[model samples]
Target chain A: EDQVTQSPEALRLQEGESSSLNCSYTVSGLRGLFWYRQDPGKGPEFLFTLYSAGEEKEKERLKATLTKKESFLHITAPKPEDSATYLCAVQPPGGTSGSRLTFGEGTQLTVNP
Target chain B: AAGVIQSPRHLIKEKRETATLKCYPIPRHDTVYWYQQGPGQDPQFLISFYEKMQSDKGSIPDRFSAQQFSDYHSELNMSSLELGDSALYFCASSLPNQPQHFGDGTRLSIL
Candidate 1:
């Protein structure tokens, strides 16, 4: 079974503070790694998709990097609005279409202003 | 750009009752996926469809059934609802090998 594990279940930071969340995974053949941000009682919003090691992508205050065995979501100078549960999910290689995602427990980040 | 849209944002049901959740995929996207997230838990894959055909299955209960229509819309039919069925159900859509975009989700509550 494909598995994903995220470190630092909960994190607290002051406004403008920077930090990185980690997600480790084990899959038969990784097709993609995804990052999503979810607010309380809300569906996850898409963040980034890292397809290969040494790949990195960024969006505003967030940057995502992937390695062969893990991925990192680096929050740069975060603000209170950036606080949310960050989720990491992995997609395994599959046939035709619509591969399922295996998600980690997630890291709840709280940025205090 | 349009995002995945889910209907009946919230539903309340009693045990043994049935409920249906609907999803409209983003335009030009052909794959739809269903996921269930319990309180304080990450979303769990339930099922998926592509090109109006069932393409994958996961931890979905036997009482739950879902299908994608010709219009690329999908519905999840859940029967014999139990308290354990209460959760946030999310629908996502994407093109082949692309990142899936999620809907706001339907919050289901069983009493």
Candidate 2:
């Protein structure tokens, strides 16, 4: 069975603190790994998409790196406005439902001012 | 840039009632996907359509049905509503093999 797991269900950090969130997955064949930031009561906003191991993507203070079995989202000097539930999802290669994604429970990050 | 659009941002229905949710994909996007997110849970894939055809299905219940139209808009028809069906329904759109763009979603509540 394909599954995505995220660790550190909740994290509280002071402004400008740095931390990393973990996402581990077990899939038949990896196609793409996606990261999204969702604010309360709103739709998820796209962040980054990692397609292969050893690949990394960055935007502003957020960086995402992927490996064979897991991925990491590293935040640097995070601000209070950057706080949101970070979601990790994985898409498997062509199958009955090729485009369907399996998502992790998400990491709730709270950056205090 | 245009984004996916969903109608009836909120809906309240009683048990055994039926409800319909609509989705309008971004212009020129040919694929549409539907997902259901329960309280405090990750979004779960329900179904998808490509070029007005049912391309794939996930854990959607038998009481629910969905279809895409000629203009690429889609609708989800759910019958026999239950409390468990109260959730946030998200509609996403993308070109084949591209990253999907999601709508704000409709919050459904059952009383």
Candidate 3:
């Protein structure tokens, strides 16, 4: 079965605190890794796409890095508004180049002022 | 421009009834997909429509069916709805296998 396990299911941090979330997966064939931010009562918003090992993508205080077996979402000096569920998903074999994403359960981050 | 549009933002139905959810893909996209997300769970794929045909079907039961039109719009129909059918159904669109842009989703409550 294709599976994605995310670590530290939930995280709470003071404003400006930095942390990292992990996503490890088992897929039939790996094509790409993606990160999304979903606020309560809203659809997930795309954040980044990593196409290969050693590749990294960044936006604002969030940065995503990929490896052969895992990916990391690193938040630097996060603000309260950044508090939301961060989801990591992988596109496996069977679908086209960028097909349906197999998502993880997501990590909920609460940033406090 | 709209990324994706799904109608009936919220629906309440009784068990054994039928419900049809509609989706209009982005004008530039050619693929439409459906997914169900239950509370506290990740989204699960239900089905997908591409080129007026079914391209992918997930582990959902037989009660669920889908249709696509020439314009690339799609509909997901659930017959004999059950209590477990309550969920947020999201419609998304994209190029063949590209990253999908999603709609706000429909919240269904099967009583």
Higher-lDDT candidate among 1 and 3? 1
The local lDDT score (0 to 100) that residue A86 gets in candidate 2 is 98
**Model 3 C-alpha lDDT per residue in residues B38-82, reported as the tens digit of each score:** 998888888877787777778768998888898888998899999
DockQ for candidate 3: 0.54
Q: Write the per-residue lDDT of candidate 1 for residues B2-111, one digit (tens) a residue.
A: 88999999999999999999999999999999999999999999999989998889999999999999899999999999999999999999998788899999999999
Task: Give the winner by TM-score.
Answer: 1
lDDT tens readout by residue for model 3, A14-87: 99999999999888887778888888767778788888999999899999999989999999999999999999
- The TM-scores of chain A alone, one per candidate, are 0.98, 0.96, 0.94
Candidate 2 per-residue C-alpha lDDT over A19-90 given as tens digits, one digit per residue, 9 for 90 to 100: 999999999998899999999999888899999999999999999999999999999999999999999999
On the 0 to 100 scale, the lDDT of residue A84 in model 1 is 96
- Sorted by TM-score (best first), the order is 1, 2, 3
- What's model 3's lDDT at B90? 89
- Chain B of candidate 1 versus the native chain B: what TM-score? 0.98
True contacts kept of 3: 0.32
Tell me how candidate 3 scores on lDDT: 0.87
The order of the candidates by DockQ, greatest first, is 1, 2, 3
